[model samples]
Target: MTARIRSVNVGASRDGVGSRGRASAIDKQPVASVEVRDPGPKRGGLGSGVVGDDVVSRRHHGGSSQAVYAVAREELDHWGGVLERVLPDGQFGENLTTQGLDVDGAVVGERWRVGSALLEVTGPRIPCATFGAWMGERGWVRRFTERGRTGAYLAVVEPGTVSTGDVVEVLERPAHGIVVPRVFRALCGDLEAADEVLGARVLDAQHHAELERSVARRTP
Candidate 1:
């Protein structure tokens, strides 16, 4: 499926459902619809050499309608294939609604092109309370972080320019043979699952340290 740059609004909510209460009084910045592209030198550089491009500036709650990119049914199907599940129409909070791409399997430091703009998978989503609140679940954030299924974060690698209906291709997966889920599970604090996650060696330094800690804890 392909995704297009749609209007983006970040107020205390994406749906504009609930009031931001006093939060808006302090920091009142209306989220604007920005064309998804490599934000250029004004934003950052495009490559593994550019560490500053790692910053993710947007965070929205509820109202999924006004997001970075809006996906059509076909694009959703593409994302669903990667997810291994049929996704609801227009149900992603992505700046780039991608199709035929396994976004989750993308390991750290992989880049792909969306139209002319290049985006790279740099990190995973950090579960937050607002997301849980938006999901209408009290503990969704905890469960989400614990599950470690959050999609990876993408950094603009090449400052081309991205709009809607862009076809996304998988430039790379972990050639290291270690999956992201394995790292998350190994550090998820679930002993049984941790064992399975740590069953294999992970290249991430943080994960390797955690595995060592887990082994030490179990030994005693």
Candidate 2:
């Protein structure tokens, strides 16, 4: 299969979709197309980089460094088999459900041209209480983290439109070779790998804060 977006999804803010009964936009639905752009910093910025998509919480979701979320259809399928459920595109709250791309294997700072937008691989999606609640599987957070196929968070480097069936092309990759899954593991508890994450200059400097914070937590 060609590297392409199988679906573009967006969700509106909704009640009871977040941790502690807070609002969330996790139940994304397919859309024909959407516009993507930098949403500025996490606080005091637009909610979602994809226009019309609502990110109810800005505390740790949606921003320039996480302007978009993309997940591999293959990964979704694999999880579906393990979970014994039919997982649809965007079921994981990813904005783009992609085929024929290694979302988790993508190196940090790798750039892709999705439709007309230039997006950079910023980091992996970290499982959270909201995500666990959304999944409704017992120990969902722990299970997902342990599996470590966390997909990718992308930052829009060039504003443009994206649509289902649009080509997804890798334009560049950093030689540092730190991939999304490795980064996830590092952030989780891999102290040695966490050092790599903190020390890698090839990684996006804009996202270094989070990596550093994670490492700091495990430091002492």
Best by lDDT: 2
Q: Evaluate all candidate structures by whole-model CA lDDT and list the values in order.
A: 0.43, 0.89
lDDT of 2 by residue, 134-220 (tens): 888889999999889999999999999999999999989988999988888777779888888878854456556766877777677
Q: Candidate 1: which stretches are off by over 4 Å?
A: 1-92, 190-220
TM-score of each: 0.51, 0.94
Candidate 1 TM-score, true structure as reference: 0.51
Clashing pairs in 2: none
Pick the TM-score winner: 2
lDDT of 1: 0.43
For candidate 2, the clash count comes to: 0
Name the Cα RMSD for model 1.
Answer: 8.7
